[model samples]
Target: MFPIRDHNPSGRTPYITYTLMAVNILIFLSYVGLFSDERALSRFFFDYAAIPARIVTGDGALTLVSSMFLHGGWLHLGGNMLFLYIFGDNVEDEMGHGRFLGFYLASGIAAGMIHILSAPDSIVPVVGASGAIAGVMGAYLLLFPKARIDILLILIIIFRVFPIPAWIMLALWFGMQFIGGVGSDPNAGGVAYWAHAGGFIAGILLTIPLWLRLGGPGFWRRTDGHPPHPEARYSTSRIPKVRR
Candidate 1:
């Protein structure tokens, strides 16, 4: 199952989220050609992506930020962007643009640090915005736990769309990350599950002050754990009748 959209709409424009998506897309496009050349791609990833060994050696420190905009393939980019698109706007709305941007960067950096700590001797280069986007998902869970998310479920030929609480979706996602992180080796270099899990926890901790400022548990009671505005309604258009 994948989230298609959320029922809650931000009261203001989320310019930062839009800009982040565009930047990630543009950066991915810049390196799309290198996919056909394995050596060149490896070189590029080694140079820009977060390498745990290099980080442990006190080198390539800038990669923590650079790596957030890089992706291994089209699917990697698409999946991360989809999650960001679905969850980012509301978090950005809650935190305001400047603070939200800072939160995103900090969470990503924390994620990279956690990954480096997890496998300091691994030479594999980790690249993707998933860690940062995971942070967004975490914040969304805390801020809008009751918000309805429309998820598209597909099982072979069976397909369906269902609306469920944001907390349920995010909780399941976090649980999967934790399970994957525990099951896989960090040095294997496939999915950075630890980074995702780390970023998620960081996001919740980072958003706690904001949540408190909004009145903590009382905030939930006030907004019912959703956006403090009217929910958006979606409907399908009926087919037009054909004239004889």
Candidate 2:
């Protein structure tokens, strides 16, 4: 499923989130052409992406930060950006631009550490902002649990857009990452489930102070677990019809 939009609107502009998305896309496109040269791509990943073993030995420390800007492929970049785009703005609005940027980086670095712990010996270079974006999802789940998100579901040829509570979507995502991390071997490269899970948990914890400052459970009551503003309404009739 893919989330197309959220009902809640941010109180302020999410400049930091937008900047992050731009930087990640720019960095990925900078070296995407090397995909045809397997060796070059591998070398590039090793140098710029997060390698668990290299991290454990105090080497390639820069990758903990650099890797957050790199991605595996077009789909990888797209998916991560989509998630970040969906949930990041609200958190960024709540935290303010400067703090949000710092929070994003901190969450990503923490995620990298968790991934390294999961596979200290694996040489597979970790890429993508999923772990960091997972952090945003975690915070969003806590900050606006009752907000509605429109998710596009695809089953064979049957397609539908369903609106569901933010908590449900974010919780399900976290559960998947947790289960995947436990069931899969980190030494084998694919999804860095542990990193996603760790980042998500970290995001929640890191946002606790802000949550408290906003009055904790009282904040929930004030906004009813949604952004404190009017939701934007779009007309479905505006959609264009396609025919063969």
Candidate 3:
């Protein structure tokens, strides 16, 4: 299942979210050609991506931040940007642009650290905004658990778009990451599952203060566990129904 959008809308413009998307896209374009040349790409990743082994050696500290802006490929960039696009706006609306930017960076940094800890000796270089976006997902769960998310699911040749509660999707995503982290070795270097999980936990903890400031359970009671605004509506998909 892939999330296409959310029913909740932010009251204010999400400049930070838009800007982040642009920056990530631009950065990926700058280096995407390197993918055609494996050695060059490897060098680029080592220099700019978060290398767990380098991090533990007290070097490449700056890469923890830089790496969040990088991605392994087109799909990597697109997937991360899409999630950020879907969930980030409302979070930014709640946190304000400046604070939201800080929260994003902090979560990403924490995620990189957790990845480093997961495989301190691994020389593989990891790059993506997933960890940070995972943070946004985490906060979205805490802030708007009942919000509706429209996800596109494809089975064989079947295609369908369905809406589900935000909590279900986010919780499932988190659980998959946690389980993946337990099953895989970061040294093998595919998905940074630990980073995703760590960033998610960090995001929730980081948002707790804001949650409390907004009135904690009182806020939930007031908003009824959804975005603190009217829900947006979309026309139903044109896919024909299956004949029974």
Candidate 4:
């Protein structure tokens, strides 16, 4: 299922979130062409993307930070940024711009380190903002458990949009990542499920202080688990009649 949007809107402009999304998209566009040239692309990733083995060997220290902004493909970049766009604004608003940016980077670096520890000998490059985005999702879950999110479900030829609570969707996503991480070999390259999982948990733990500052359970009572703003209204389209 895909998330079209959320009912919860940030109280502020969320400039940081917008800037982050634009930056990631711009960087991806700059290097997407390299993907066509295997040699050039490999070199590009080697230079900027996270290499777990290199990190374990104490060589690619900068990649832990740079890799959060790099992505391998359009879908890879799109999906990660989409998640960031959806959930990042609120966290940014809550943490303020500066702290939010620092939190994002820290979560991403931690994610890369977790991957390196999980597979120290693997030579594959892990690239994407997913780990950082997962951190945003983690924080969102703690702060807005009852917020309604619109998820688009595709069942073969059928397509439908369903509104579910934030906790359910985020929890399910975390569970999937855990299962995927356990089922696959970290040394074998595919999805960095462990990074996603670790980032998520880190986000939650990191947000604990902010949550407590916001009055902890009292905050939930005040907001009723939704954003502290009015929900947006969207009209449904009528199905068109087809001639037989």
Q: Pick the lDDT winner.
A: 3
lDDT of residue 102 for candidate 1 = 99
Q: Give the TM-score of candidate 4.
A: 0.96
For residue 13, give model 1's deviation from the true position in Å: 0.9
lDDT for each residue of candidate 2 in 1-244, tens digit (9 for 90 to 100): 7788898778777889889999998988899899999999999998999999888898899999999999988999999998998899899989989999898998999899999989999999999898888888888988899998988888886677778899988888889899999999999999999999999998999999999999999999999999776887854422245678
Candidate 2 vs candidate 3: the lDDT winner is 3
Give the alpha carbon lDDT tens digit for every residue of 26-68 in model 3: 9999988888899998889989999988888899999999999
For candidate 4, the 10 contiguous residues with the lowest summed lDDT are 234-243
TM-score (all chains, Cα) for each model: 0.95, 0.95, 0.97, 0.96
Task: Give the alpha-carbon lDDT of every model.
Answer: 0.91, 0.89, 0.92, 0.89
lDDT of 1 by residue, 51-92 (tens): 999988889999999999999888999999999998999999
Candidate 2 ranges with C-alpha deviation above 4 Å: 236-244
